[model samples]
Target: MRRKAYDDLLAWKNGKTKQALLVTGARQIGKTYLIREFGGGEYDHVAEFNLATDDVTRESFLAARSADDLALRISIAADGPLVPGHTLVFIDEVQECPNVVTYIKTLVDRGEYDYVLSGSLLGVELENVRSYPVGYMSELMMFPMDFEEFCWATGLADQAFAMARDCFERQTPVPDFLHERLSALFHRYLLTGGMPDVVAAFVRDNAVDNVRTLQADIRRFYNRDITQYAPRDRRLVIQEIYRMIPGQLNNPTRRFKVGDIADVQRFSQVQDEFLWLSRANVALPVYNVDEPKGPLRAAEERRLLKLFYSDVGLLTGTYEKRSTLGILDGLGTQSGETSSSHDRMNFGGVYENVVAQELVAHGFAPYYFTGKKVGELDFLIEDADGRIRALEIKSGSRFRSHAALDKALVAPGYGIDEAIVFAETNVERDGKVLYLPVYMVSLLHRTRQLV
Candidate 1:
């Protein structure tokens, strides 16, 4: 329930010439709850309205003559006067009424009221919203809780979280006790996801079944949106694309190639649908990085773009029980499922994407390295000095340095400062690359200087 984004809102409230703000994120990410928590505590009076649940109120605003009249209508609906500096008005699910975006823009432009509008999906509503107060309004992006935040929330706080936060200068090695606990929780997070409701359930019941049920409910919400939000013709295509996510990410080439989708019939039909999904924040496109520099331009090959869902747990939910063999071992039983061939391929790809997702959330952009012949580096992470650090992520621990990694290091111009091979446990260096556990990837961002 504690989110750092709320702090940004407070800072915005206290700023000079503060404008109405718009908060955007995927569905059920606690957008509404965040506004209420932040606004109620910061302002003298809080008036909240949901455009999706309250249609009559929306209709009244639509019929109003001007922005001032619309604000007056909202105040009447809330059974209070909209007083500036005293009231913080919040409109949740603003995507449910596209017309309101323009109205809010006009109100902010005309200085009618201080407000915050939150939307789970704005791609559907952007069609009608015109003349956005671009310069006047601040847009805030909210993401699912990161590993550190999750630890703090679940009462698992220890040195790992502290170290990741850079509370100290030197890198603190995760002690054995902390590593084991964190490893288990990380696996659980990969299963249950950061969806607020599911996370709350896990915290409340601590039951795997409860978490799975909640995950299913979130999937159902997504499935329903395919029909509810997308056009009839685009509905099935969107559904198919959604279904292909787990398999696509699990491929030897993590990129989402058109050939991977069975019964594609046509790739063009699904392309726009995929873009819509990305706009909704349900799917994130990890572009193939040809350059490690800032603005990390996507490769000329558009087909190389990889697709990752908003949550790792949501991705796992799509696979059948049998297919998830090595991908995950489930609650507490480690059955050594990684031995199977199918499990090996699928599991490896998923874990790589997981690492990629986590690193991206931590302000690191990942790029892959491929040799002229046959080897490939899983990722090339650029540190603060603009130095490229090559990294290879494995499923568990069974990884041998590839020829591509060797070729990458010896290549002409690109000078890699350090090479890392991330596995299941910390180990010594193998030739050019240093071996580290997958859990230690967060620590890769900073250098370990001895005191």
Candidate 2:
């Protein structure tokens, strides 16, 4: 499947970067496959090793004394001398032997071969990989296939996006036929998600059941990771927190209350558990901001927040089949799944989750705004131009009644000029507000740089 990160790999390879490349993300996000694909085409010989599955090689890497010794050990394992400049030395599952990262700098300095390293759980596992070569590494964070990549995998034509972008900029409605079809496809994208393996299976079999099954398998893998990577005492807490994501989001406020996990538990007690999950890339927590400002992080209230699954497809797998049908058929606003104690008629949480995923993948830090006077906005993001914009997700038919957005527009002190209502409707603008289809969330993006 086509991925946006492949371009990043190509740029790293062609840039002749002296720094070794580090590809990091949650497991099964296609980190290994992407690197091997790039290395195979760009290098005459791609020597690959995985520390997770190969114990002897892991020991060899850890015992190496110098850059020359590291190269010799790798060549011995590869069964021959690696070509000086034509070879790409690829390391996988470096989380098992993080010292390999420290070696990356020395190897790059030798300039014998191009080096690329990748692993999962690095945020939690590699924290102690002492002596990290800060400037000697270029890092890339890989997310699940975003909607645009999903569109490409599912055979949606390129012109469709071109047309949508045109209509979005022109403030015109998409043709009725295209709008209806695109909406349906957007639903499919939500169910299948951006997970490459699941997306590929859906593309080939076109089976929702198979997609659900595969997504479930990935969730199970995540469960096993908790046992393996998380601290023994924190494992149960992390596991429970992961399972609670769906029901937590279903709440009216969509705020993750620590008390719900256990009546006596407090946020300060399990703060590290939440950090573990966040760093592992298993769950995404969008904090509440005191005020929507240029740097949204300044006002972020970490304790009061909404937590979403890393992928929406995995999220849907946690629910019953009826909820899935409700989403597909566009039956009503509420999923109406009554099996769980936290069940609700509202599907706003699911819609909010998808939008959150889209925003994070597009390189934006999304926050929710709730105030005594301004009410709650589903999402607030600071644009590249350093102005905050309010975003709302209307999953129900009552999309027109946006009290929060209306209030914020003229709330006096916020200085908010524009608000977007992402609903299941055609494109239109009402003064400072722009109403866009839910699928167009993929189009909300801008490039930014840090000082």
Candidate 3:
């Protein structure tokens, strides 16, 4: 499968001042796969070492006294020679031996072979490393396949994505046929998500049930990690927080309330657990900004926040607990199944979550605004030009603006001249607001660049 991160790896590899690269993301999001793919294709010789599974390799690193010694041992361990400029040395599961991270400084100082290190728990484990090779390491964050990458993997041509980008740049509705096709594809993406494993399975068999099963297994793996890595007493708290994500998102306020899952009256008591999930890349938290401005994070309300699962497919699998293929196929409600009012509410949350995912994938820090008298704006975004824009996400065709968005657009302090509404509607402009179909959310970052 194609990944945008691959291009980043290439840039790092070809840079003038090269540093050891550290690839970080949640487990199973393809950090390992991407590094290996880059190494196999870009290097004449690839020395791959996985510390998690290779005890001998770990022992060699521990025994080495110098970069040259470590290099020789790693070359032997990889059953290959590490040549300068032509070889790529990849260290997988570096969290298992955090000390290995510090070795990057030595390796880079020696200027022998190019190095790439990857770990699922790098953020958590880095705390214990003897020293962080601060200047010697470059980091790239990997995320689940975005919509464009998903399109590439599923046999859609690059031109298709280009066409979508062109439409977004022009602020025009896509041709009806392409819009319908993309809408159907986006629905499948909601269920299959950008998880490479789930996407590959669905593409191969065209079975939503199989994808759901894989997603469930992925969830189990994450739970197991919490149990295995979290402090013994806090494991249950972390698990409770993880399980409450779907319900929290469904709340009308769209803020994660610690009290909803636990009996805690204060967020500080469980704040570390929330941080743990975010650091682990299992949850993406959107903070509440009291004021919308250039430095949005300055006025963040830490106590009020929304947490979204890292992948929308996993969220759907956990929330729906059944195959959504029928729903995607126009069979609204399946026979013999009764969906509650809460289930109906979840549809909006799911749509919002997907928009959040797309925004995050494109390097936006998700923030939202709730006004006492004006109403709520689903998201507040700052474009490349440092302009704050209000984004409202609507799940259905009945698109209507709230006073908060209108107020933010024209308010003196807000400085937001235009607002964007993402809904099941075609692209159109209404006064200062632009109405766009939900799928176009993925094109937002690119559209900003064009503007």
Using TM-score as the yardstick, the better of models 1 and 3 is 3
Local accuracy by lDDT, each model: 0.67, 0.84, 0.79
Q: Per-residue lDDT of 1-451 in model 3, one digit per residue for the tens? A: 8898888888887773747888888989988888889999999999888887899888778887766777677767877777787888888988887767776788788777888888886777787777888778888888899887787888987887788778888998888988887778887888889999999999999887799899999999999999988889889999999999987776676689887766788898998999899999988999888877767878798888899999999888875554343436323221122454333333666777888888987888879877775667789888767778788877643466356677767666676646888877678888888988778888867332100
Candidates in order, TM-scores: namely: 0.85, 0.95, 0.93
Predicted candidate 2 versus true structure: per-residue lDDT over 61-147, tens digit per residue? 889877678777888888445898898888999888787887788789877788888899988998987789887888888888888
Candidate 3 regions exceeding 4 Å error are: 63-69, 321-345, 446-451
lDDT tens digits, residue span 1-451, model 1: 8876777787777772747888887888788888999877887788888888888987876687667788678878995666776888898888776666677766776554578888877756565576666666777767677655566678875666664334223333456676567667766666666777778887888765776777778878888887788878788878877777877776676767776566665556467878878887787766555543333443323445677887777776666645554434422112122443544333665566567767765666566655455366677776666667877776654456355677767776666778777666545565676766565665455331111
* Candidate structures ordered by lDDT, highest first: 2, 3, 1
lDDT of 3 at 293: 75
Lowest lDDT sum, 10 consecutive residues, model 3, at 329-338
Stronger candidate by TM-score (1 vs 2)? 2
lDDT of 3: 0.79
